[model samples]
Target: MKVAVVLNPIAGGGRLKRHWPEVAASLKRHFGDFELRETQAEGDAERLALDLAAIGFELVIAAGGDGTASEVADGLLKAFRESGRT
Candidate 1:
């Protein structure tokens, strides 16, 4: 399945950024294809997540802190609800 990883650039004090190569490698092992999106600003993650969900991505993974995760989840949930599949 296709997996989209939404990562916040400022997350974990840039720890995620440092480990992105390793993370992407690990994700490739589990998914046939994947996409990575780095948040450009505070709300970018949520917007990207929502767009992905709206476009029918089966999985949207958030790679960030709780706040970022919550934003992505909210976006996904909103998309799901709007699509009437929840």
Candidate 2:
């Protein structure tokens, strides 16, 4: 499957960034290679997610806290709505 990971480097007080090496290794082991997109600010995750979905990625993962996940979901939903698939 085509997979994309939208990451928030500063989330959890930078805890996610600290552990990302191991997390990425595990994901690669299970899912093979994936596209990784790091968020630079509040709206980045949403934009990344929307673009990934529009480009036919089968999976888009939000690798951050609740807010990041929500943004990714919103983006995907927006993509779906725009495509008339929702």
Candidate 3:
């Protein structure tokens, strides 16, 4: 499967960023090769996820708290809506 991960580097008091190496290793082990995109600001994850979806990524995983997940989902939804899938 084509997988993309949208990570918020400073989420959860930076715990996610600190643990990302191990997390990436586990994801790679289970899912094979995947793309990782880190958010630099508030809207970056949404934009990245939208682009990823537009290019036919099968999955977009949010590696942060609820806000990141929501942004990713919104981007996916926007892509789908624009493509007449919804």
Candidate 4:
């Protein structure tokens, strides 16, 4: 399946970026296709998640701390609810 990994570039003080390669490699092994999106600024993660949902991506993975995950989930859930897809 296609997976969109919405990463918070500033998360963990940019430590997340260092581990991205391993994360992407692991995802690639399980998913047919995968894409990475780095957050440019505040709220970017949620915006990216919403955009991914609008583009018909069934699975959007959020990789970050609690705050980042919450933002991504909120955005994805909003999109899912608006689309009436549960």
Q: What's the lDDT for all of these models?
A: 0.88, 0.96, 0.95, 0.84
Query: Model 1: number of clashes?
Result: 0
Q: Which stretches of candidate 2 lie over 4 Å from their true place?
A: none
Clashing pairs in 1: none
lDDT of 2 by residue, 3-84 (tens): 9999999999999999999999999998999999999999999999999999999899999999899999999999999999
Tens digits of lDDT, candidate 3, 1-86: 99999999999999999999999999999899999999999988899999999999999999999999999999999999999977
TM-score-based ranking, best first? 2, 3, 1, 4
Model 1 poorest 10 in a row by lDDT: 29-38
State TM-scores per candidate: 0.93, 0.96, 0.95, 0.89
- The top-ranked prediction according to TM-score is 2
Total clashing pairs in model 2: 0
Candidate 4 lDDT (Cα, whole model)? Answer: 0.84
Runs in model 3 with CA error above 4 Å?
none
- Tens digits of lDDT, candidate 1, 15-74: 988998898898888886888888888888889999998887889999999989999998
Best by lDDT: 2
Comparing 1 and 3 on TM-score, the stronger one: 3
Scored against the true structure, residue 3 in model 1 reaches a CA lDDT of 79
